[model samples]
Target: MLAALAAGCPGGDQRSISGKVTYDFVPATYSATTGTGTLAFAQASKRPVRNAVVQLRQGSGVIATTNTDEQGNYRLVYIPEDDSGELSVQVLAKTSSPQIQVEDNTDGNAIWAMGAKLSGTDAESESGTTLSLHAGHGWTGSAYDATRRVAAPFAVLDSMYTAAKAFMAVRPVSFPALKVNWSPDNVPQGGDKASGFISTSHFSPAENEIYILGKAGADTDEFDSHVIVHEWGHYFENNLSRSDSPGGPHGRGDVLDPRIAFGEGYGNAIAAILLPESLYVDTVWSGSGGSLTAFGIDAETEPLDTDDPTPGVFSEASVHRLLYDLYDSGTNESSYDKVSVGLGPFYDALAGLQKTTPSMTTIASFITALKEQPGVDSAAVNTLLSRYNIGPITSIWGEGDSRMFPMYFSVGSYPYNGTLTLDGGYEYNTWYQNQYYVFVGNGSRVTASVNSTYDVALTLYQQGDVLGGSDKTTSGTESVSLTTQNNAIYVLVVTGFKETDGGYGISISITSP
Candidate 1:
């Protein structure tokens, strides 16, 4: 959908059109509670609508197309195909290059936009025209109206713009196309996505789409800049970096799998790194009309949950705080926050070294490589790691920890038989929940089997890539067969289907041709 505005005509021999675009958004109160939160907003301020599609239109048809730059300015020059048609400029809720669209899920995926036109003789001006258009927040004293609701998509755009610019500043790269699904009907419910039941604001790796909540009187995220950047962070990690996390319900204080810890922590920290403010805030009202600002996290200064029994390498709070401290400039609140190598070094480790590391993606793996990056202050990194009681990550496989040392048992010869115990601790689908063994393949078809006290699962990996896996519903044992690749080293992972109490046995033998 497009809304129209007015523009001034010019007098130039060659026809040319140029202008700027902007949008308004209501800002969220920092660390707001019901007692401090209010519906009143200061909406006079405007921000440049960066990187959106801008079109020069004649009457109802598009005559030329361009993109708004970082300053929200665009210029178009084209020969007149028809002198009688009215001239106009249109800015869409979409961007060029790696396209990103904010769609109305409740409707038929309509793209919102702002357009401005010159009527009568102004349309046929010999010179050029300068146009300016803006998208309003749609707030009419008490509530937002339909016509003024165009700002949501552009607000989402601004956040994406901020995030993209931050990464490009740190490194040179192109982003993949992405679509953000948002609508007034989008709600926090379990149902069809098109029907506006967005469930929550999250990125779907399978669909490569982001779903945002947008129920007017209830939970709406159109103005939640941090939430938008947070989800975009997930998209970046999945596409640019590596994410081995098994998705599940997790919380700030919960001790999670190392993969989950890193994935979630990175997602949260990217927001702090990109946003002007380091505070992560989300606002929402309950369906019953109860005003409840969702949550706020001060990644820079929030105190860790001291009561959590296991808070070392398995905590997300520790992971994100560490990441922000690494890139953030000027750290004085704590002596441990001394390292300030900036986003470049961190980006290098994440996209280059950490991507192909043999270990499962985790905080330990990321920080281990982060310290190894050239010119990094390893002593500062070590000091920061010590603050969380996690220090000297010598290996991607998490060395130095007694529970993790001798990470992979080696089976040098054929007809290998071994029994591994994971009594240290077991949380279903966690990094420590499974045991690993390494062996050189002999180019013959082989069967790898695992027998355990509970339902068992087996998986094989070669150089950080999955080779084979077997997950049978039946309990007790599981096996997978794969032909060997000469002398290539392979890692076999064994785990119980359910929570495990103790010992598990593994057998790898050549299978008959």
Candidate 2:
């Protein structure tokens, strides 16, 4: 259900006020090829503040209240008694939604608002009375004035409204409560959330909060719709689908952990799909708010040729491009991109097979699940996979791909040598930095060991659920023992902390007794 808005009483001497709300949105100019762009206040665009609460207040008491429609238009009717108090229109940076609240994390977590005074005489002046209120970006040609910067929170709220609409378009949703913390004091520094050092603009699954970078003259995401929706995509995946990604720093070109690539790329793809355009722009400010730079990319047209050098299943660039091609009704540059399943079918895969698969949520798992759904074009989908060199998808475990990709190792092969090494340029968070082994538990205790010069981290899981493992900080032999169920499949992962000091050598073994 939406908000419990008051139904205004209209009878004799019905006084009403109808109006529209709008905000200033700055635009960015980007290079389609390199994704570099510029943004300035001079090019600000006016956009609607939709799905927000609009109120007509009489002095301190509220005479009538209503919600803005999709176009930021609202109408409120109130009966006139004695002209004892003044009337004003107040708009809050909150939605009666699929409830999303944009709060000032630095200032008591309060919802932001701006007001316009309305006279009672004007309320009943005519049959169709209207009022217009707009929020400005507060730029004074040289710099920004914080007091006049009232549109930032409203801009952020609009993105969430767009995301809710995109999801509800496909199916009815009873969206859970969500809080978005934003403030001019929010920065990338790590500290208490109240002080506004949010670490970064990201969605925290632990706190169930999305923190947006709001420090001026550094980086602010209020105007960046893609960044907002990208984080929302994370929340959607966390709430609805399954995410096995070990979150960390990732880029478009780099090879990543399979789970991370799919997660990040899906975030990028969701922004492209839900936003008004396919272009994704993330803006950054220099030492002064007057100087702004942005990075833009076209998810629908980015190419991944056969000769491109990077991780195949581990490239977020490949993941987003493929997903955008699948959903958008546009022509793609990739020769293998002939499939268009749209968002509804794409979502079907996420809420269905992808959620329940035994394997970690990777592209292989998602694509395999997507193909299993009804009415999806299988042959065309395979063409796209073939271009990326992704193996044939038949199972959530990437059926028959281990021969070439070697994603999984067999527990039957004892005294196995792991091939994952610590390269000087490689970070420890990537898929190539770890090795995985799978085996069926015999309803008995099983022991696993990894011998290495550096710290060896080992984690065990059963059907995507974490069990228990060991990751000793000291080097030598890292071993873990655990009991397993009969015929239940279990996966063990080993990551080396060599730090490019030596080879990624470590004999691994798993035995049941």
Candidate 3:
């Protein structure tokens, strides 16, 4: 009997099944094979099924197994691992093929034909593509088709779009209807490209695009989600400040400005809050190597240096640490700081306004209202704080710490005595800890001529309550006079310095006209 069964089986001793799957009337593409084909089965009841497991079973032993593709077609291969003789096939949740016997005949054609006839009921209509996406209100451009040849089941694109729309709805401006394209090539290795980004022109509005890697939900990652949201955050900030200073005096562009730190931080925070499950998977997945902490940061131990620069707002490491602290096991003082304290109220105001107003239109209005109230820099902080609402942020520095420290200034001296010539210099002091400075005035256009008698050293910190100075040096007498176009303030401070002399000093002078 076993020999007879083997003789009747298709592919003879080799056991394999091939067919196509479809869901909701759409053909499902196989991950291993990119081909699409129609399922030809004699049975009509077993055509469309969901979550049905398809497998090749030999006797009681199950061989290779795979679930039906979303479109109800599945292919199963019988590997050498399973005994090849009498085979049993089954269809799930349907009465059609409770069990079917296939003989592994010496000539495999019969078994192959027997296996090929397994079919399912068709549950979906063979309808044409009628899906349409609208570019809601405040969208500047007309809709454009963004279809491309790529892997299917790109659900991440949908998630990114939903998040972006939600975020924009809360803002006070109209977001443009941007076309999105998904491609493995365009998908960034470091972050998701769906988050919106602005064109390079300093004043140009942001361009809208979303990119996704076609993969199963299990294969999709979290960085892409976070990055896409972060880009939207930039859009909110830029649109809010359209008429304000281009980049602010710091020279950092809209995205990099220190004033926008709150915005960046908020973006990350919102990403965390909304996608907590995704966050858990990314952080806790054993595939991630067990180093990911609850806050989605690497917690592996590493060496540290005393002189390393403190992480800035843009530092991924620093931002991760701060976020970890904020979202850690329990709340602490940092949670109630100015930035943290104001975030909740600000968010509440924006939410309330969003009910009656469109986001793009009302974002600026809501932000303006929040700024005019109290303790907020309406021109800068309100827009950012309201969106992410981390609460009040503690002042960046301590009390009595000079917010602005002077680094160099150009002024003529009867005797120019300073080792630091037209170039810049540094100063250090124990009292200057937590102190930052503003270097005011232009140094390049000093007008004073060479002189020996009158000596002058550029003052480091002069205006604020904090009194700090760099060591004096008498290198040569050169009357350096700098012409002032307009008084410009350059701020600096020892982010980190040794306490040896309480402070070290290097000579620097700003020449005056």
What TM-score against the true fold does each predicted structure earn? 0.85, 0.88, 0.33
Give the candidate number with the greatest lDDT: 2
Which residue segments of model 3 deviate by more than 4 Å? 1-160, 167-169, 176-182, 187-223, 235-267, 273-295, 298-509
The residue-by-residue lDDT of candidate 2 on 356-464, one tens digit each, is 7767788888888888777888788878776666766667777734422466666664334454444333665676566678887777888888776667788887756
lDDT of candidate 1 at residue 63, scale 0 to 100:
71
lDDT of 3 by residue, 292-368 (tens): 12223221111033211333332223333333233333233333222332333444443443222211111233333
Clashes of each: 2, 0, 87
lDDT of each: 0.73, 0.76, 0.30
lDDT of 3 at 340: 33
Q: Please report the candidate that would top TM-score against the real structure.
A: 2
- RMSD from true fold, candidate 1: 4.6
Q: What ordering of candidates by lDDT runs from best to worst?
A: 2, 1, 3
Residue 151, candidate 3: alpha-carbon lDDT: 12
Per-residue alpha-carbon lDDT of candidate 1 for residues 235-328, written as tens digits (9 for 90 to 100): 8876777777666666766666666777887888888898857877788875465554556677777454542345567777777777888888
RMSD of 2: 4.3
The deviation in Å at residue 152 for candidate 3 is 7.7
Q: Looking at model 3, which ten-residue stretch has the lowest summed lDDT? A: 131-140
